[model samples]
Target: MKPIPVTQKLSVAAQLQPDDFQELSRLGFKTVINNRPDGEEASQPGTDAEAAAAKAAGLDYVFIPVTSSSMTDSDVRRFAEAIVASDGPVLAHCRSGARSFYMWVLAGDVDVQGFSDDKLVAVASNIGIAPDASRAWLATHRRTGKPDVKGFYDSRTGSIQYVVSDPTTKRCAIIDPVLDYDEKSATTKTEHADEILGYVTDEGLTVEWILDTHPHADHFSAARYLKEKTGAPTAIGAHVVDVQALWKDIYNWPDFPADGSQWDRLFNEGDTFKVGTIDARVMFSPGHTLASITYVIGEAAFVHDTLFVPDSGTARADFPGGSARVLWKSIQDILALPDQTRIFTGHDYQPGGRKALWESTVAVQKHSNPHIAGQTEESFVALREARDATLPMPKLILHALQVNINGGRLPEPESNGRRYLKIPLDALEGAAW
Candidate 1:
């Protein structure tokens, strides 16, 4: 897209992307103002993507959104303030440059010096923006907010645990935390949980919820342990019952309950909750497992095992109840979110021995994530199946599933106080050497 200059201090573009920031920086743009709110239009870029790009390009980025239906004075003021603070030219963008151009013209403090409203209207007209209609919209939009997120890596399972918090009140939710386990000694430890606990304490964060993306096959869940430590209620996808039922048969436990009674709360799709004042919701994203669900909290989504890092491709779907076919649908759903949404994944294999990385945007995944970037459902399934066929099962799958399916609780002792694990031999397929 071409940039239209309004003055020496500013330029307007219809919308900006992470890749666009570099050229804008080269063009001497010191600041970028996002006049688009997150999820305003499904699949449109969000502030996070633009901000990350701007940061990498050494440009200051600010989010000052204005909906087409309602543009408030506060929105204009915020835009004006960001423009005024820039040391070089500024670039402001939205779905169409109309919202941005309208904000610049309406933002009384902006330096549109010799151009009056009439001239601004003419300039907008040439750019195909209906200024009058946008003016009508300007007559009512407010700005939007963001979330606070942090990730912790467990070296053992290559899992990434996250703490998503409400900055205003410091209330937070922990997502997909790992339980430290040693298969050689059959020992369980709390180092992973302790790190999260320590961070929460140091940050003065109130643990509002303990979440498990699914019953992990790679590592034991720290949900129950974290809840015990923090007294926070635990939650998992409602379909965990299905997982329990499936695994119960495999383990040959006749009397085990298949109902999901272990978790404090069971989340179905579209279920909403709060961590402090920030709103969060659930999306059923299965395929890595039957119970895998994503926790979307205010522009950030914890998409566990759906899509891996761009370099690493996606998660395997050859496990029980797993389907690369279904995973394609799930990934499509996630990519349908605003492009700027911050996606914190569950694991990172540190491909090529690189450092662990979990943070990426929906935009990045849509274009670069090797697995889903351009492949169709049929192609993805073919490729995923081919790859999964060559990879061995996770080291702890046998040990972890029993504990994870039982709400991360060790089994009851038989007469003796010592707990024992039920490792079913010849029960699971692909029992790799």
Candidate 2:
């Protein structure tokens, strides 16, 4: 049997023979799990014979036979228990190795702490194996202490602002809050920020952080305003410096500080923080923007700009420093999260005039997103590039970036006591006419 290593401790193989048991023992496998049912094929070896061979070969053996239609939660738990009880490495086998691979995938749902979702997807992709029951498995499993998510849709900008809170502690964070701007009159207001503040006050929530997933292009960020009102620290991805550098030149501001010092905190990938008792982490997801990030708080992930509603496909990747291929990889990384993990999109177009939606599970995105379900990296890049070429830049990109890059602070007032935005003409060329 040719064994395929799924992880450092687990390997899978097509039905093992009696002779192969000794080889497996010599190869340091401490346990053998049979995922194949007996007597389905007359030529197949029975579990009893396999068990005896494994015993004689000085290896522990367990039979957890699973059929395509008969695999259940109990079977997955037993598989996880067997692995946990094993002394060393484990070698599981099934008719064609696919069943064992799937069993391992399902086992992860029961043993989330024992497995890394990214590692599982990486090995599964390497072996050309994918779980068919991922959605069903996630639907039945529940993770405790999931954060409460509330989405506030801004129809004018089509951006979704969020307040993710730990229900037990009543501590919350405002994510991607919008600073209302009316370009026609060149007026800015705190209507959206006040609405979020009202929710926090009504719910008796304490604001611990004001987080921005990225420097948004469509609307100005209310991060600075919220911080001043709440006295909470403001933060964004550390890569904001790169974006600041690129935009600083575009704006022709030589005195601009591009060191990402404007914000109270700059989070790197894998940086961990807390909102009350809830654990949160950062994942750098750059494609639609150079500094885009996803804040993974408990079961909810604030994936800003990289992914929109599945029906809306992904975001445009033709912005400065954006790459379609890079965006595809970032999308895959988000999809690799646990199927039950809640995916919170930053914006939704409400395609076909449906009500706005910002919440989806990783399972839904995996199975339903048109941009991801059937498209490979090469095809997705081609599609993204072709589509982006036909779309014009956001209306407020020039107006928003100046304020956003400076940590959502409006320009200093002149001696006349009035502030103004600096718009660079023809800076973004080749945009759709």
34-125 in candidate 1: lDDT tens per residue? 88889877677688788888899999989887786567756765666676568788888888787787777555313532243356567777
Model 2 steric clash total: 0
- How well is each residue in 1-433 modelled by candidate 2, as lDDT tens digits? 8789877678889888899999999899999999998998988889999999999999999999998667786787677767766879999989877777777765543223223334555655555555444433322432244667778899999999998887669999999999999999999999999999999999899999999998999999999999999999999999999999999999999999999999999999999999889899999999988999999998778899888767888999998999999999899899888765668889988899988877665765766688998999999999999999999999999999999999999999999999989999999989996
Q: Quote the RMSD, in angstroms, for model 1.
A: 12.3
User: For model 2, what is the error of residue 71's alpha carbon versus the real structure, in angstroms, after optimal superposition?
Assistant: 12
The CA lDDT of each predicted structure is 0.81, 0.85
TM-score of each: 0.70, 0.69
* Candidate 2 TM-score over all chains jointly: 0.69
